[model samples]
Target: MSIPILSILVFLPLAGCLLLLPAWNCRRLARPIALVVALTELTLALWLYASWKGLAVNPFPQGFLLLEDAPWIPAFGIRYTLALDGISLLMIMLTAIVFCVGLAVSWDSIKERTSLFLSMMLVMEAGIMGVFLALDLALFYLFWEMMLIPMFFLIGIWGHGRRLYSTLKFFLFTMSGSLLMLLAIIALHLLYAQQTGVSSFQLQELLKVQLPLETQLWLYAAFFLAFAIKFPLFPLHTWLPDAHTDAPTAGSVILAGLLLKTGSYALIRFGYPLFPQAAQMMTPLFYSLALIGIFYASLVAFAQQDMKRLIAYSSIGHMGYVAIGIAAWQPVALSGAIIQMANHGVTTAALFCMVGMLDERAHTREIAAFGGLWGKLPLWSFFFLLFAVTAMGVPGLNNFVGEFLILAGTIKSSPLVAVLAFCGIVFPLIYMVRLVQEVVFQKERQPLSLNDLNPREIGILAILALLDIWMGIHPAPLLEMLHVPVQLLTGGTP
Candidate 1:
């Protein structure tokens, strides 16, 4: 039998979490140990990607690669199952990279309770990996809920002013949606049992059990609500800015990079495929909501004085494009949406890391407080500008490719949505340029001595910058990986 490599990848960080307990008293060793563990996980992800690329057979249409299915509950048909496809592979890679970068960024900032912080980070990584790998609905739900604990602790214990409020709000919003999803899962399970005379939560098995359109609509809403809350679509987005503003730098990176993508991933993996008719019927509503979110969040971001808050709002707008592309339900649009997930993860995480660096030095996240930083911290300003241009969807940057494909695909379906999304792009330019102008070009507001980014920080930003450029110029590899899977999902030709 082949090794259960997928399980190893999913739980390696949990192993790291356990290993971290013994080193709890040694503050100096905590971060180094965590970094090593994160890098190991990243290495495993890269290997998985390489192995997948070399495979002669396409594993996605057959359901997944490195698939593992073993009976766990004989009576109810629940199983210990995990697998990966192009989508899961890319998301796993992003999680590993972001966690490593997040840990590196926290090296100097987290001075107290170092062990607990690193342990929580590892646990969060484990949970995210599990979410990406799980193929059974019950298993997926377990991993989905597992992510909450570590993130709650990270934000509530290690965050800034109003952390408690932000933590509670974030928890309540996500948990409430999760409960509705749980109900829907149980309902689906029971319905499947009634129809097939067997109980199961296996996604592939469940996909074969078709429900009536009315039933699909109700079930889809339950799933969509859960994902939308996590996606934080439009009005449900209230919890996001607060969470991003108050959470620690590492927490913000994880939230922006990995957590937000899970919502879109779930929609693609489960919500749409499991309820195709309902998904088609609901497309217009989702497109409308996404457009509104883009316009609304971008407008709000322009008015923000706090740097983190501005970026927080900007994330909502960026994700709105992902939502639009997914709702379009075209293979090209879905491919764009998936690639955009990675692009947004890399670009936004870098932005948050840069803001964290600025905050660490200046002790403030206020835009007005940080003027003429280019004069004092040229390297820092340069990195910030790079990511800012990427965020603006500037040509020859990562964002431009994804946004262009999304617009192209969207226009084929709904020219109006394409037009509206195009208008939304302008808002990012307004706020992003405003951000660059006030922070980099305008005169310094206060007389304060500031240091530029350190070697470690520069390395992290440089890696992300290179990835942005590579994806912008030649996204063929990313698009190629997802081509079969996206075509399969959308029932379209590559």
Candidate 2:
């Protein structure tokens, strides 16, 4: 029998979380234990990457490359089913990478309740992993909500000023969405049971039950509301900046690097695929919101004085490209969207780390407080510049390729939207360039000592920077994993 790789990947972190509970007194062990588990997860993810050749010529009966199915609740058709495809695999890998970075960055920053902080992070990791891999709707919802508890604490307990306010806002917004999605899930399951005369919450089985356009519209709206709130698309994105500004560095990293991606991933994995007609009907609205998000977030980012908050807004803008790509619903655009998710995760996470490091040394995140850092912190300045420019979608960087492909694919669908998006790209460059000047190169506003990047900080940023360069130059491998799945979705070559 094949190894239950998916189960091991999902539950391993939870196992680590349990292990940490007993070590609450031995707080010193928390970091190493968390680091070991995170590293192990990353190793497993890389192993999968290395061994992956392509999808099988014959797809699995359940439509996943790797799947595990067992009855968990026979009466309700809820099952302990975990399934993985190319997209899930990518998400899992990204989760592993970002989580590893999160742990590394938190090594020294988290002082009080060390064991608890690490434990929450581990729990959240498991939840995210389950969300990516679970094929059972019930299981997926369980994991989706499971992630929230840890994040809520991460922001509320370990966070900074106004942490309680941000935490409350985050909870209210997310809970409202989760309840809607739960209703939709329950209704969808019942609908399936009524049609097939067998209750089931397996995504594959659910996909087989056809619904009228009206039903699809309602269900899709429920699902979309949940995702869009999480996606925090445009007008719904207000909570993100506050959350990022208040939460600890690790929280911000995971929030930007992985949590946000889940929203778009679900749209691709479950939302549009489950309700194709509704997705088509909603395309124009998504496109308009995406464009508006890109432009609006860029302007707000440009105006921000807090470095962390600025990067937080930049995340919303970068994600707008993903939304637009999904809205376009073409092969190339979808591929770009997926790639953009990973690239944005790496870049934005690194930018947050930079801000955190600066805050650690200087005790502030205000942009006006930093100036002429190039002379004082050359290493830090260089990395900050690289990631900032990458975020700007400069040519020969990670963001550039994704943005280019998105524009290329989007133009084929709607020339006017493409033109507007193309213009939106310039906004990032404008704000980012201005930010670089102010933070790294402009005249010193006050006399203060700032240190260069240390080995640990350098290592984190270096890994992310290499990824930005590597993905920008040779994105073929990522695009390869994406090709078959995206082809299935778009029915065209990616």
Candidate 3:
């Protein structure tokens, strides 16, 4: 039997967290240990990516490339099942990269309780990894909730300006949605057992049971509510700007980068595939919400005075495109959405890191507080402008590829949606260009002496910059991994 690389990838960080407990008093070792663990996870993810051969003869019917299954609670019909497919693989890669970046950003920013902070980060990484890999409904939810605890602490304890309020709001919004999803998962488990004369929460097994339209609609709504809250679409997105504004930079990075994508990922993995007819019935709702979110978020983002809040709102708008792609329900759109997830992860995380750098040096995130930085911080200004434009979906950049594919696929489904989405792109450029003009080019309001990006900061941003360029210029590799899974989801070749 082959080694269970998936299990190792998921639990290694948890083990690292455990390893940190003994070193709590050894404060100097905390960052180094966390860095090593994060790097290992990234290396493993890359190794997995390199070794992957398509699931040409997947033993599992769900089209997973690597799966590990073992009995965990047979009496309750739960099993320890972790599986990976192309979508999950991409997500894992994103998670690992973002975590490494998160730790790097936190190195100096999180000064108090460093050990505890690093431990929480590692635990969060473990939980996120599990969420991406788990194939059993019960196990998936376990990992789902596991990730939230550390995030709560990360924001509430280490954050600034009404951290408690933001943390509580985030917790309430997420937990409320989680409870609803739990109910849906239970309903499905029970429904499957009633028909099969046995209990199982395996996703592939659950997929075998044909749910009634009424039942599917209810279940899908429960799951959709859960995901949309995390996706934070439109009105459901009120908590996000608050959270981003208050949380520490690393916390914002994780929230924007990996956590948000899980919503869209779950929708694809569980929401639609489990309820085809219900999903079809809900397409109009998705499109309506997505379009509204795109316009609403972009407008609000443009109006924000806080740099972090501006970027936070932009996330909502970017995710709105993802929602539209999913709603289009075409193979190209679905692939684009997946690619968009990775793209947004890299770009937004980099943006947040940039914001953190400015905040670290200036002790403020207010857009008005910064001006004419180009002369003082040339390297920082260059990367900031690159990411800002990349976020705007400029030609020959990462965001453009995903947005273009989404629009292309959406046009085939609904020319009106495609047109509206195309128009929505302008709103972001409005904010982004203004940000560049204000922060990088405008004359200095007062003489300021902020040092430019240091070696560590330069290294971090440089890696992310290369990714943005490489992915934008040549997305064939990403698309290659996405093709089969997208084909399976759409039941057509992309």
Candidate 4:
């Protein structure tokens, strides 16, 4: 009876893409159209957040809210199901905000085949929204793979040197993991059918059918491999630097801002809940890998000369914190992990956008190529410093709150992980400070002539900066929204 708000939220961008087809020849119209659509999605997400009843009162049935379920395939028992909770709601909001900012920043930078580029971005957005909303396993997988195509084209077509190689590698790595997940989805569906005489890919329905420990372990591994590759956890993270280094600015923004979050979201939404026993068994392994990634990625980040590549490695390290929190499985840790996902998304996206702005003007991303920018571009320098310190988890910034909670929670669960993670924090500080010194404060290497950020760029960075500060100062609303769901996930009293 009520309007299908979730469906509109998911498909509105694709509809925008369709509307753009008529105006493809009008290069000027493409960005405005895309911006309008992206902002509309953001507005809807804000509305959803505003209207949401707190979890204390509503307590999502099976960890879902704003559900829209309907039978799409009666014969196969596959349904067109969508739902949201605090976690998915936050992810969708992040996707919308990032896409809008990404498009705003791309307006002047992306010139060649602008229409196609904007279209791909919208399609990618639609796919990401679907991933956050879909409650059916089949639907979720569809959205998961849907996002890859546009990104491949974005990187392969619009990217810098080594674009083709990087695109292929990114595609292959992601596709391989997705295929494994697909196989696991089928196995779960069949196993459910065997137990209940009804085949379904709905997550809630499947959750009720228990599997043996061996089966759980096998299935969990399949899903974990898929998520870990996307999360780019440690050794599985080889594809990321290449992808980030060569991707176009918009490509890098979406990849860092939203694509990576999907992996951690999936891990929380499906991995642990579906295979609790295996998740329990694998906690130690996850903690070890997360700790290793935290240290190894931070060290590698410090040694990088390419600014984009440095930020890329920094992403791995930040996500490693998410992994550590998730593995700890305490309510505080899980809440921190969820918040960290958004925190890292904003901070890293800002970093990549700043680097892209520098690269656009200077034609280089080498740290040595930049110096004395603080004198030339004070506004840019201030934002760069703000986001850099935010990334380092400086107190009174977004990353600090999430990192603090994660460390405190990990200390309660595993003091050793907490200590190792604390030590890993030092490397990021060294690298981020070194970056600030070389790029902003040090004397110019070549007396560069760079302009301050334009109104558009400043607007994007300002929104992100304010968000970072706001989250740091007042994280209660976010933490409260997450509290019940996190407690439920951790098997604690909600």
Question: How would you encode candidate 2's per-residue C-alpha lDDT over 69-129 as one tens digit per residue?
Answer: 8999999989999877778888899999999999999889988999999999999999999
C-alpha lDDT of all candidate models, in order: 0.91, 0.91, 0.92, 0.91
Number of the top candidate by lDDT?
Answer: 3
237: Cα error in model 3, Å: 0.4
Model 1 lDDT, full chain set:
0.91
**lDDT assessment of candidate 2:** 0.91
Model 2, residue 205: C-alpha shift (Å): 1.0
lDDT of 3: 0.92
lDDT of 3 at 32: 92
lDDT measured at residue 378 in model 3 versus the true structure, 0 to 100 = 97
Per-residue alpha-carbon lDDT of candidate 4 for residues 351-464, written as tens digits (9 for 90 to 100): 999999999899999999889999999999999999999998999999999999999999997999999999898988999999999999999998778889999899999999
If scored against the real structure, what TM-score would every candidate get? Answer: 0.98, 0.98, 0.98, 0.98
lDDT-wise, the better of 3 and 4 is 3
Q: Give lDDT tens digits, candidate 3, residues 1-494.
A: 28888999888998898889878977778889999999999999998788666443553555678889899999989999998888899999999999999999888888799999998999999999999999899999999999989999999999999999999999999999999999999999999999998899998899988788999999999999999998879779999999999999999999999999989999999899899999999999899999999999999898999999999999999999999999888988988999999999999999999999999999887888889899999999999999999999998899999999999999997999999999999999999999999999998877677999999999999999999999999999889888878888888743
Relative to the true structure, candidate 1 reaches a TM of 0.98
- Residue 178 lDDT (model 1): 93
